[model samples]
Target: MSDSRQFQVALSLLPYVGAKTAKTLVSYCGSAEEVFSAPSSRLLKAPNVGQRIIKSIKENKSQALEEANKQLSIAEREDVKILIYTDKGYPKRLLRHEDSPYILYYKGNADLNAQKTVGIVGTRKATEYGKAMTQKIVRDLTRYNPLIISGLAYGIDIFSHKASLECGLDTVGVMANGLDKIYPPAHKNTAFDMIDQGGLLTEGCFGTMPDPSRFPQRNRVIAGLSDVLIVVEAAKKGGALITANIANYYNCEVFAVPGNLEAMASEGCNKLIRNHQAHIYTSVEDIEYILKWDLDERTTKPIKKSVGQLTMEEQIIMNKLEEDGGTMAIDSLSIKTQIPLGQLASQLLMMEMKGIVKALPGKQFKVVH
Candidate 1:
């Protein structure tokens, strides 16, 4: 609703600019609003700012802005939350990735940055085994209270969402289309329940149909939003495998439930594990151990220690947690501490071990006290 946000939404709707180019434009111009106002000569100075893109930006400025206003109006009327890349509520994990969407239209009460988040994906033609595995994994994950993310497609996707709901866990449906309509239409009731318990998320705008090409883009969001992506079952190729690969690329952990070597549903998971693309997932403990979520469920918060006794990195992270009201996303902490993600993750794990901090569900940390 702010003019700047309207501009950002408009900039995102540009014909030629996508996540990458939009990032470039924002980096060069300092903001989406500035990009639209910038002279063509100045825009050309940015890398990959060729004449074609620049022309599209200039030519579509008015139309895009008009459309953005209309889109925002619809979102407001429909109770959708429009999250820009720089917004506080934007998924911190996704923001850390290079190819994250410029804007997202979300309609949900669930925190996008829940302390523990997992993406459950698999083949659309799910097997009985796949469905059972999805239910079991989701039910087991209830102890950790993770937010479940999945594409709202048929087979495994729907099964995951329904299972999460039955287990009383919040589950988000990431759609290839806009929020205006649910894809596969049959999952309408499940989606309706999610809006209150978890909610639907999408990068697409109103009127955007579930085009086949857009599903890959949708898969990337599923990968980015999750701390770990689980492949309950998959084939040699499908949206689930695509999500696993993307999750790996983003430095998020990928887990595959191994199945019969010859079974069609298990082939993809088996290949991923055999080829070293993903870890072999047998039980909930594997996920708990890898993510270090194995902390005693009943462990009470430890008393705080003096800053003098802490390591430099630990003290810095602690101070940031204090500043952030005793909690912060891992990515936000990394940015505040000026620490590399890999190093930050390691330090946080060590801190968790020391009882100096507690890892929450959505990749967040809080001082134990």
Candidate 2:
């Protein structure tokens, strides 16, 4: 229902209120409804509460709620999901950043919190080299089944999205404008396809235009969503570089494709590497190394272990691994075995000592024959 949702959306609509201020209000007032219901005297008691913000809230409260109601109606009509910052369905990775948007309009099937996520960003003026690399990277990363994140702009962004679709990988497009209107209007078909496979996400509300300023803001979302960001190509001053910089600030691993020297598109990437802001990306192995992903199963010969001798819990772990190609991460094993991480880890260690299973990189395990 749009009951609490209207107020949550309205919190973002209030004048002079941004992500931090909105979060502060919610923290102090318990909820958006309480923030509205609280008197000016109580509002004054909230941290950083100023006369201007209070007046804006008091005067425009009804109008913001009305606007929120309209937004909810439009979202309902379009099948768009409005994620409040506090919602469990909101992207957990994005929530870690202090400047992350308090509201997200998402329309897609992709899990924003997929086990692996790779952000691909580059110049709008992508060359054949850049375009080729974008697809190459997406295709190469298929083994990990990572969710691809991009800005949905021309050149590299669109290339990544299309590549992801072709590879059957989920890819989310972070747009600078509202979901109600796809900017550039050229990639409409691809955007529509993404809605089924991956999805589109934006912090902008309905009717929000894609201004020059909003692109940098959008870049931050792409960076925040990604576990690791790959810059296929970038110019000296572009959204791609901005995204890479933001990723570095957020402590997210970043990789830059090595491009030819004396090329404008390569300048940003080369500079990023030279400045130690990003790692040099050559192959999918580079990603696997940084992320500690155990994509390839161990090829070593399995040790003989009798299945009948295994404890009930060890048998459960064995069954799950065998069900999932004889390999799984510790987190995944715990999930499938209905065991807590601490207990699962202890059991896996004992199994390893008993030669019933072998450990692999990235905290993964494989059952021995």
Candidate 3:
């Protein structure tokens, strides 16, 4: 590991600073190295940087760096990839979140920033219906070739991973514990298979054990990494619901597979849909439609329109769609076009009505051939 990365790892290891606080420190100091070297007065000026955290940074600077070096050595031995926030290999979508981790230990070959990604989460005590739905969704989603993400826990989590692997799709297992250990130990074989096909990702270090509190934090990473989060089955409360809420907060599309209203596993999905927190998911087509994923790329090509015949705004939007591989999130398009949201929405609606473009469920759009 480089000195900068080592420092970042060290900074993340500090007990006084979580992901959010770490982000603030880095933003204020300009770099992780600078955070450690900057004067106490300079550190205090950063938002949420209190006296206690400053003291921790000052007193444990040497110890933290030493520990970081040891962690790096362990990572090297384990063939784990240490990705700092600024690293090219880091997940781009996750990095957008305010509380995204400063250091991620990854072990896998799958692209962390795959063009299409979905997080499938649900109850650990999965029912038969839940298992069937999970498999079916993964199988159908293969057509879009999306990277599958799930917490590598029991029930729905393991089922999603297994189904993805069976469908020849890349899948990532986000763990609550360190990469050195796979929780539920029963899923060890599945985890091993993923390392070659996709990867095992975590913010936890080598010695960190699985704890109840860590799972919610892990769920946020799952929410952040995905473009959409699919709740296969969940109770009225569980980590899946936590992930769904986080995904919504991140402005990522959330989808839930509905079940019999009386079923325990279906309550979360039903509630999310009723509350307008998630879209009702019935088929893979719903996913493809919402994400603007083209079943046939040829069909998504822009309709022929002479530059002279189109409005300047229309032309600009079309260019952006083309640049973004024929699909883009509406928020991204609005920002790229520098068009106000209301005006952009009106324009997109007009385009959709004219069949010049199509709108997907998640405020995503694409040019129609």
lDDT of each: 0.90, 0.88, 0.89
What order do candidates take by TM-score, descending?
3, 1, 2
RMSD, candidate 1, Å: 4.4
Q: Tell me each candidate's TM-score.
A: 0.84, 0.80, 0.87
**What does the lDDT read for residue 184 in candidate 2?**
74
> Which ten-residue region of model 3 has the weakest summed lDDT?
294-303
Put down candidate 3 lDDT per residue, 1-369, tens digits, no spaces: 689878988998887888889888988899999999999999999998899999999999999999999999999999999988888988888766678987899999999989889999999889999999999999988877989999999989999999999999999999989998989899999999999989999999998899999999999999999988999899999899999999998788999999998999899999999999999999988876666665435454445655577799999999999998888778889999999989998999888766788875346687876
Predicted structure 1, TM vs. truth? 0.84
Candidate 1 lDDT over residue span 168-284, tens digit each = 999999999999998889999999999989999999999899999999999999999998999999999888888998987776889999999889989999999999989999999
List residue ranges in candidate 2 displaced over 4 A.
295-369
Off by over 4 Å in 3: 299-344, 351-369
| Best by the lDDT measure | 1
Clashing pairs in 2: none
Could you give candidate 2's per-residue lDDT for residues 99-140 as a string of tens digits?
998899999889987877889999999999999998889989
